[model samples]
Target: MMAAFKVINQYWLISITLICSKILPISSETFHTRLSPSYFSQKLGKIGTKLIINGIDSHYRSFFARVQHLTTPGFCGAAILDSRFLITSANCVHSVKPQDIHIEIGDFSLQDVQMTIYDVQDIFIAPGFNLNNTPINDLAMIKTEEPIPDAHQISIGICDEEDYDMINYQKSVFGCCGMGSTNKDPFIKLIPQVLKEMHFRGTPMDESNPERFLPCREDNICTRPMIDGGSICNLDHGGPLYKFRCGSFEPECLYGVASYSKRKADRHFQTCNTGSFFTNLMYFHEWIALTFLQNSF
Candidate 1:
């Protein structure tokens, strides 16, 4: 009974995933969109699928941390930045106290990996972050009680403008990876925390759409699912919008943070592939470096 109270309010700390649907698309009409993935074959790209980039566990290595809200049992996406720091969206930890939240790692498939939970020693949100605004310096870092073992420090990446732009125009498809919300429902034992992945294409900035209000300027990058029926729905916030480098097989850079997505209909309670927005990581590279230095000692 106590376990039931834990997951009642969990949400995806990553995206509300912008890409269109996946795995056979919902229908003939749902399978075709301007930015949808080119092929409709049985290739894998779904929210619950195990991450298999180049057949390695690289995805699990990096974004293995979950910033769990102790009381609400809510969660947000986070990743290992260094031995002592885990990074996530500033809004994810903005209002909560450091002691109230915990970081859980070392688990991929909820059933397989032995989970290690750590208390947050400190919380550091980016400078000038505003929750009212969709995406602007939407970043944060948390210090653990002690350094996470180096063996668990597998996923590492950089945020440089050069690499960010290269993937922006050059890459044909980008992958949004996350282990989003696992509803804390009673009938179910809690969903799988396995890393899931989806594909989407960069879309032109749309500032005047009424159904959505995300402004994809220098700080935010908008996306349309590369395939129809794909989306990073609710409970998947603070997720990563990443892709492999040119001629490289591994995803070494995380370019953006999944912020939010528009609803399917004005009053409906579903996510739409209509559009999605993410916080650009390159924009805050200097600030992040500075923030890390200030907290290093």
Candidate 2:
């Protein structure tokens, strides 16, 4: 029965993969018109200032062959330790060379002047990561050659283990950030947008994949938006879902990269829905310490 189930799942995945290959066109004007001003207002409410990475244009040009460029591509990532390191989803680094990935900071318009481009020297993928499950180990670390200056904008937060444990499955909120999409249309030029918060139910993992380092409970929350390859800002898998410390929204670290949804259709159907999974970073804290921070102290 297990074998049969595996075969059925593979068949379904293949069918979906084939359908996602086709490109659908959308006009820019129509795309922008579809988005309500309220949506932008809502997004801005969560994150006041936008962060842009500089040197992305030249990097994109140099490494376009690699890296999966999403239709509406810019994704949000937090600066780790004063811009020397960045914590983001593994999907962001998947299949791309170190030279290709560029870090952008500040607003979009002045990206060229404000952003800092760093060449990735090493990429560390969490162990036991499965492409199918995309479980917790869906995290990666990008090591830059040189340290970035004026990295005051880059900050890391402490993980709230207490909040994560007390989280109510039904009422919990999952916040995510990225370049917001204009519309569900597939052909629109991808614009760089900022973060947005959405409410979701917590769905934990049934069984832990310790080897791959994934831990999720049925009650863990996930975003149901159409975008894929984005990170859960304050959660595990590098970006931790954070709640504002002073208010009800203090950023707290929760789940990590585990799994994501693939495009199964086009603009007309469920094609807009792209789900990404992350691993719980807390589970692999030891690993990160041994690997990245071992020699720091």
Q: What TM-scores do the predictions have?
A: 0.71, 0.54
Error of 2 at 277 (Å): 4.0
**Relative to the unseen true structure, what is the C-alpha lDDT of residue 117 in candidate 1, on a scale of 0 to 100?**
86
Model 2: per-residue Cα lDDT over 86-118, one tens digit each: 555675666667665665554432234344456
Q: Which candidate achieves the best lDDT against the true structure?
A: 1
Question: What's model 1's overall lDDT?
Answer: 0.59
For model 2, give the 10-residue run with minimal summed lDDT: 55-64
Q: In candidate 1, which residue ranges exceed 4 Å CA deviation?
A: 1-61, 107-110, 133-135, 151-153, 170-172, 182-193, 207-215, 247-249, 264-267
- What TM-score does candidate 1 reach? 0.71
Candidate 2's TM-score reads: 0.54
Q: The CA-based lDDT of model 2 is what?
A: 0.39
Q: For candidate 1, what's the RMSD?
A: 11.7
